[model samples]
Target chain A: MRSFVALFRKELRSYFGSPPFYFVATAFLAYAGYYFHSDLIYFITFGFGLNIMENFWQILFVDLRLVLIFAVPLLTMRLLAEERRLGTLELLLTYPLRDGAIVAAKLGACLVVVATLLAGTLVYPLLVYHVEPFAFEPLFAAYLGLLLFAGVCASYGLFISSLTDSQVLAGFLTALPLLLLWLLSWNEAAAASGTLPVVRAISLFNHFQPFSVGVIDLRDVFYFLYATGLFVWATLRVLEARQWRGRR
Target chain B: MIRSELLTKYYGSVRAVGGVSFSVGAGEVAALLGPNGAGKSTVMRLLTGYVSPTAGRALVGDVDVAERPVTARRQIGYLPEQVSLYPEFTVRRYLGFVGEVKGLARRRRRAAIGRVIEQCGLGEVADRHNGTLSKGYRQRVGLAQALLGDPAVLVLDEPTVGLDPVQAVEMRELIRTLAGCTVLLSTHNLTEASALCSRVIILSHGSLVAADTAAELGRRLEGAGRLVVRIDGPPDAVAQGLSALPGVLGIERGEPDGQAGVRFVVLASNPEPVQRRLAAMAVAAGWTLLEVQVKPPTLEDLFVRLVGSEP
Candidate 1:
């Protein structure tokens, strides 16, 4: 745990210290904020009912999802690849710490950075309160689902980052998998036929749709957790494999 | 405190390190000597838990490196050859992080970071971003990080490959100061090893050929010493001139050292005759002997001889 703290602080400090970390965080924050609030003032001045808040919440949820998908890869790309390229991974590995702690601390720190950006979007909700304070349940549900979805994305990005020393390669490979998951639900008719149950089950965005609609489905929650676990496990395996290859 | 028994590592079908076995007790410094790709760094990688051995095992303080890696790695500090760091981090935060990961308590962790920063001469740049430092400074940062937490074993690969002469000397002294700290530093710089390490391990093509004290390896590999005589006289004349002198085995002309000079070395089973030939050859041909010096068996000689003999 102490080791994890050390690693976590290093990760957080690294992000705050590097220009890229700030640049990426700021860029995503600006873009996602603007996408959700271009018409926020207009809606508020005219006075909206609960329905307006719901629509805003829905748009905000989508915006949150977009942030999770794109911003996470940027953050994770350098987590392992840059360390490997710089060869500091050797120095870090030699420390009296476990590989999981290293991975978790880094991954956790990035999630916090992303969460901070997501937290920045709270301004929109406060704006909604001027017209309607609205219900807490649905909004909280959507946010929770967004977090679950982001955890899965971040873990997958960390996995991709572990596989290569090139940040660009890690970023592109991570995006490739994410793009498929994001767009996978588009073929709903194919999923409906039941022939591609496995394919549909693998699509994260499809599972996320239940939460986006404000329904707390256990199956979807289970699926997201499972996806997160799968990627975390894969990342661990990849790190272990790297050692074997590096030794010989 | 550290030991390896027949540790071998393979990458797909390619073998990077094979059948290496060596041990270092606490307060001892073992130097791994080899040319590039000679598996010196690979061995460090295995012992430090950066990479796992494909076969056999590495034990650091009785903790099997692969099976209980986290526990084992906690006892080791590694300075990789690349000397890379988190460019944005200050030396303090970086080492603080490293100390934390090593499981030090907060107060002790801070103390350790401060000590290492001072020890590695990083005090001047403790707050500077790692990316902004010079190569020498970056290497110092790498060294500083490796020193964090003062683990039971320290594994450094080519730790001084890029420092200037003065800095290299300082680095050597620092490594020696760490004598009581169990250490394994690898380098192609034989002089560095002689000046710093107590034991030298020679690796050629991933195999351990000889491991001994610096002087012992030198004496065992090529024996006492010999001299290379490069002269302006004809090759045959130089050869004939030095031939049959007591303790002289023979003479052979080497490739041209320059257009005007024919270079040849004399192999004497003993050192005395080589010294005698230096004077005799200088007078015999008025040959403008460009360079005539007796060379002793050094770690470099041992490295070259062992590597040259590898099949």
Candidate 2:
């Protein structure tokens, strides 16, 4: 447990020390802020209501998800890949650490970085409330949804990062799967009746839809948790496989 | 207390490290001497638990590295050949991180970091970023990290590969100060090995060709000391006379040493009497005897002989 904390602290320090964290953070905030302003304009033009907060939460959640698809990959591309490239992965393995602890530390630290970026978007909602007041319940649910989605994306990106030593390749490969999932739900309404439900079930955006509308569905929550677990597990396996290969 | 028995590793079909084994007692400094690709690094990796042996076992103290890597790693401090470091981390921060990961108590961590900073002569660069330091300083940082928790065994791979002559000497001196530390350093530098390590283990083509104290390996590999006699006499007659001397085993002609004397390398198990006899023969023949120097076997000679004899 101490090692985990130590590794976590190291991970966090590394993130803040590098330029990529600030670069991705700045880009995420700028992109989300632009969409937030546009969402605010639409909200003002459309006027406020009991449903205004729900719509606002949905817009914020969707824009945040879009920003994360790019941001998370950039943020996580170096989690393991950079370590491997720098040959520090071998050094880390020599430490008295369970591979799982190393993976968990990286995941935990990256989640914090992502959460900070998401937290910056909180100002948008606070600003909206001054001009047009709304309930907090839906906003809470939507933020929870965003956190879950970002963790899932971050884990997926981490898994990709563990697959190679090239940060560029990790980013590219991570974006590929995320874009596919995002596109799957994009045209869900026009999909064939037979495949529409299945497509929506697997689509990341669809899992966040209930929270966006102020309804906390257990099934959607479980899906994100399970997906995050799956990716984190996969990342651990990749790390273990690296050991097996390195031993030879 | 480090040992490996018949340790072997193969990357697919290419054997990186063949069945090789050696042990270093507690507080003893042993060197893994070999050429590039001769498995010095691989052997270090195996003992340090950076990798597992495919065919054999490594024991750090009583812990089996393959069976209990974490516990075994706890007893070992490793500095790989590359000296990998986080570029953005200052020397102090990096050492602190290593201390934390090694599970040192807060007070101990701070004290150990301080001690190592002084030990490795890294006081000046403690606040400097790792990437900004010179190669010699960077290697020092790597050494400092390895020394952080004061583990039972220190495994260093080519600890002085890229340093200038002065820095290399200083690095050797620094390692020498670790008098009671069990060190297993792999290096291609024979002088470094002879200067710092009491025991030398030579690896060639992934197999340990020899392992012994430097003096013993030198004497054993290069059988006998020889005397080089520079005599101003006819080559054939000088060779015949040198061969007939009571202590002379054989004599081989050498190029003249610019002073107009044909040189002969007289091989003899005992060079003391042979040197005296050759001088007397040159005097009896009225030939000028310029030089008769006995050349003792050296670690350099042993290294070249052993490494060259490999198929």
Candidate 3:
């Protein structure tokens, strides 16, 4: 537990001490904030009889997810890749800590950064609330969904990062599959009618849609958790394999 | 405090470390001397629990590294050859992180960090970022990281590879001050091994070729001292006379002395007697004795002879 905390704190420090974290956070907030402003104007002008907060937040959450698809990879690419490239991973593995602890600490740190970025988007909700009050349940559900989605993305990104020492390559590889999953349901003609439902079922977009509408389904939550676990497990395996395969 | 029983590691078909075994008693300093790719780093990695051996076991302080890696690692402080550090972290913060990973309590971590900082002479640059420090300071910081938690075993791989002369000496001095710690450090430098280690383990082709004190290895391998004699006489006549002298095992022609003299290397069990006899023979033969110097076998000589003879 102590080793985990120490590694967690160190990962946090590395995130805050470097330029990429600030760059990604700033870019994500700016992009999310710009869409939130435009979505607010669209809500004010065209939204009638609709719950302004629900519709506004749902749109904003979707926009933030889009930005995160790209931003999260940038954030997670260096987590393991940089360590391997710098030869610090060997030093880290030698410490009195389990490989799982190391992986959890890094993923935890990345989640914290992602959560902070999601927190920045709260200003949009606060601004909307002053004009008209709204239910907080859906808003909370939406934020949870976004955090879970980002967590899934981060786990996969970390797993990819563990495969190579090139951060750019890791980022590119992570984004490619995530982008495909997000776009899986977009093309109705790409799949046969019988296969379309199965494709939509696995799409990250379809799973996150229920949360946007203020619905917290256990299946969606479980799906995100299971995917995150799958990739986290894969990463642990890669780390363990280094001992047998020999660390470069 | 540290032992490896037939520890072997294979990276696919290529064997990085064969079935090799050695032990270092508590409070002893041993040196792993080998040329590049002799499995020195691999052996250290196996002992530190950074990598598992394919066969046999590594033990640190009664704990098997493969069975209880974290527990075994808790008793080891390792400094790898490439001193990798987070460039953004200050030396103090880095050491603090290392202490934390070592499971030191907060207050104890602070004390250990401070002690290592003082011990490694890192107080001057404690607040400086690691990337901005010089190579010497980086090496010192790596050592300081290893010194934290005061582990029973210290495995340092090429601890002073890139440092300047002064920094290397300072690093050696710092390592020398680590009393009561079983230290196993690897180096290509025989001088470093001779200076800092009481026992030298020489590896050739991933196998232990020799493991003993430097002086003992010399005595066992070479058996006697060597003498270099320069005489102003016929080369063949000088060689014939030197080979006939008592106590001389063999004689070989050495490089010319630039002056009008021939040089010959005389291998003898007892060099003082051979030196005197050669000088007397030079005088009797009316040959001027240019120089006659006894050359004690160094770790380098033993290392070269051992490593060079490996298939």
Candidate 4:
């Protein structure tokens, strides 16, 4: 427990002290803010009879999730890759800490960063609330969904980071699979009607859609949590294998 | 305090360590002396629990590393050859992190950090960022991290590989001050091994070639004494004359003495007697004996002889 806290603190320091985190966070906010402002303008001008909660904030939440898919890879690319590249992983592994503790610490730090990034977008909800008060419960559910989705992305990104020492390669590889999973539901008409259900069922977009509508279905929550656990497990396995496969 | 029994590691088909075995008693300082690619780092890694052995056991304080790696690692302090540090972290912060990972209590962590800072002479640059520090300071910080928690065993790989002479000496001095700890360091430097370690474990091709004290290895490999003599005479006559001395096994012509004389290295069963006889013979034979000195065998000789004999 002590080792985990130490590693967690070190990893948090690395993220907060470095430029990449600030860069990714700033970029994500800027992108989300721009779209949120435009979406608000469109809602005010052409969104007559449209519900502010569903039409304004929910649309913004969906757009923010898209930005998260790209931002997470950038945030997690260096977690393990830079450690290996700098040869610090050997020292870290030799410490009196379990492999799972190390992985959990890194993943926890990245999740904190993800949460911070999502926190930056709270202003959009504030702006919507000022126009007309709405139910906070739905907004809370939407934010929860975004956080869960980001957690899954961060786990996969961290897993890929463990497999290579090149941050660029890790980032690219992580983005590729995430982008594919996000786009799986696209062009549904071209797919066989029978197989379309399976494709949508596995798609990250399909799972995240209910959260955008202020609905917290247990199935969607389970899907994100299960994916997060699976990738986190994969990362732990990779770390353990390094002891036998030899350091690259 | 540390033991390895037939410890072997293979990276796929390439064997990095092959059934090598050795032990360092409590409070003993030993050197893993080997050339590059001789598996010194691999052996250290195995012992430190950074990697598991393919076949065999590495024990620290009677705890098998493979069976209980984290428990065994708690008893070891390792300084890898490449002294890597988080560049963004200050020396103090990095050491604090290491102290925490070492499971030191908060108050104890502060004390240990301060102790190592003082012991390693890191007081001057304790606040400096690791990336901005000099190589010597970086190496010292590496040592400082290892010294945390005061583990029973210390595994240092090429501890002074990149430091200047002064820093190297300071590092060695700091290591020397580590009393009552089993220290096993690796180095290809013959002088360093002899200077810092009481026992030298010579490795060649991932196998233990010889393990003993430096002086003992030298004595065993010496077999016969050697003497270097400079004579102001014809090279051929000096060589032939030295061959005639009793107990002189052979004489090999050496480099010129830079002054009007020739040098010869005489191999003899008894060097002191041979030296006196050669000096007397030079005087009677009308050849000026400029210089004659007994030459003791060195660890370099032993290393070359042992490593060279390996295929």
Name the candidate that leads on TM-score: 3
Query: Which residue pairs in candidate 4 have backbone atoms (N, alpha carbon, C) closer than 3 angstroms, thus clashing?
Result: none
Q: Ranking under DockQ, best-scoring first?
A: 3, 1, 4, 2
Candidate 4 lDDT, B38-84, residue by residue in tens: 88999999998888999999999989998999999999999999999
For model 2, how does the per-residue alpha-carbon lDDT over B52-125 read when each residue is reduced to its tens digit? 78898899999999899999988888998888899988999999999999999999999999999999999988
Off by over 4 Å in 1: A18-56, A184-199, B218-223, B233-296, B309-311
Q: All models, DockQ values?
A: 0.65, 0.51, 0.68, 0.62
Between the candidate structures 1 and 3, which one is better when assessed by DockQ? Answer: 3
Tens-place lDDT per residue, model 3, A90-143, is 999999999999999999999999998889888877876787777777889889
Candidate 4 segments exceeding 4 Å error = A189-198, B215-219, B226-294, B309-311
Clashes of each: 2, 0, 0, 0
Which sections of candidate 2 miss by over 4 Å? A44-50, A130-133, A188-201, B215-219, B226-294, B309-311
* Candidate 1 chain B worst ten-residue window by lDDT: B302-311
Query: Model 4: per-residue lDDT, tens digit, A118-231?
Result: 888887777667977777788889999999999899999999999999999999999987777666656677668998888888778889888998999999999999999999
Worst 10 residues of 3 chain B by lDDT: B302-311
* Cα lDDT listed for each candidate: 0.77, 0.84, 0.88, 0.87
lDDT, candidate 3, B1-311, per-residue tens: 88888989998888988888888889989999888889999999999888889998999989999999999999999999999999988999999889989999999999999999999998899999898999999999999999899899999999989888999999999999998999999998888988999888988888888887666787774656778778998888888888899987666687765777998777777788778888899999989998888898666656656776321
- Please, what are the lDDT tens digits per residue for candidate 2 over residues A1-248? 77789999989888887787888888888999888888867766785554785556677678778888999899889999999898888889989998889999999999999888888888987876787666777888888888899889999999999989999999999999898778777766667899888877788898888888777899999999999999999998887664446531
Lowest summed lDDT across 10 adjacent residues in model 2 chain A is found at A239-248
lDDT of 1: 0.77
Please, what is the TM-score per model?
A: 0.85, 0.85, 0.88, 0.87
lDDT of 1 at B46: 81
